[model samples]
Target: MIYKALGGDGAAATVVTAAGDARPGPAVELHDPLELLVPDTEDDYRLTVDPDTGHLGFTSTTEAPYAILKADPYLGARRKQTIPDPAFVVAHHGGPAILERTASVLGCDHRQLRHSWDSLRSQGNMTSVSVLDVLARTLDDPDGPRPGEEGLMLAIGPGVTVEAARLRRT
Candidate 1:
């Protein structure tokens, strides 16, 4: 029941263009997008299809939460090495616990992640669109990143992959 409650359906879209493209009102300049598959944890989280019904399903092993928790060290290291002190954080709505842990590692206060929490509450976990949904919400937020401010986006996926990107509002 708890797991089911954490899931929700949603869809979102965004515009992407080259650096030299014409400005579309305001835009986010993307930088340093990194996707890293955590070693030895590939099977921790997975998607499966029911053979009889052909319905897709999600599964996680007992080690899944622990494996995810272990990402804090990597997150911290990356923060120090490359990630800027972002004014906003648009992250996947994995769950409240995961969101809390991510904020802790990234040194983000609750306000910085308010949009992510709101997205999770209203839309559950929308898989691929989760972060995009959060980003959309962030863009509409009155307190969201201002022009010239930096933002960070984060997501975890099937391969136990951690993807991070730097976004600057322009």
Candidate 2:
């Protein structure tokens, strides 16, 4: 019932071409995209299909949100080694709890996640597209990242998976 209320439908389109290919427009350079599955936490959030009814269902435990903390070591190492302190963060709108947990793991305050929270409040959770929606908002925000500034993208999914990337405004 809780998950159902948070479900949202949305779509987005963006142009992507090689740096050398030459497209005349604004672009955000995305690099060093990392993805990981939190060990022993796959059941924290599950999507199952009923064999008889042929219906898809989503289930999550109370521990689902905190599972993202398990990825902190890797994320922290990346930040220390390569990624710069981002001027902004674009995170998926999983929910209030997930957003709070993500902020804790990233060592950022909730105010830094304003775009994500705005998206969640306005559109609920758009699942795979939630981060995209937040990114769109961040790009459109008047006070958003400026050219040459660095940013980070983070998202969580079933299997307690973590998807992250370093972004640069170009």
Candidate 3:
């Protein structure tokens, strides 16, 4: 989705699967009702819940591969602080408060975070596909980010996983 938002064909991005224990366990079945918790801290962490699908995701920088990816020079060089406008933010839209907190953390204007809400409002939560839906909505916006602009893509999943990318509009 980030590649698509950046005007790429999604060809360059590599997909790798990681092995880990993410099962909620016998005590807490995957179908059990759950609430996401995000602590107040400086860490890059986020929790998202899809009320419609009853899916809960927890992501944090402490996770090894994502942490390593965040540290990679190529990706790290494009951190939010380095972007001029902070105009594009494609993320899982768990709810209003999470979006607000994300905007604050990214130093992005609340208006820039509208795409996610628009997606959520219009389509409900689509789980892993939510970020892609948000990206599609962003692309459909007439006044959206233009070529050469920078953006961020964030997605959280069952591994308490976080997938992020920095994009340069093409």
User: Model 2 RMSD to the real structure?
Assistant: 2.0
Q: Quantify all predictions' global Cα lDDT against the true fold.
A: 0.78, 0.82, 0.53
Select the stronger candidate by lDDT from 2 and 3: 2
lDDT of 2 by residue, 115-147 (tens): 999999998888878898898888888888888
lDDT of 3 by residue, 88-132 (tens): 777776556556655655566757778888877886656667777
Which candidate should be chosen as best, given TM-score against the real structure?
A: 2
> What is the C-alpha local distance difference test score of candidate 2?
0.82
Runs of candidate 3 with Cα error greater than 4 angstroms are: 1-85
How would you encode candidate 1's per-residue C-alpha lDDT over 1-170 as one tens digit per residue? 34434454445687888888847675688888888888888789876678999966667887766555667777777766666577888888687887887787788899888998998898778777899888888888777789988888888887688898888887
Q: Estimate each model's TM-score.
A: 0.85, 0.88, 0.52
Model 3 pairs in collision: none
Report per-prediction Cα RMSD to one decimal. Answer: 2.5, 2.0, 15.2
Worst 10 residues of 1 by lDDT: 1-10
lDDT of 1 at 82: 69
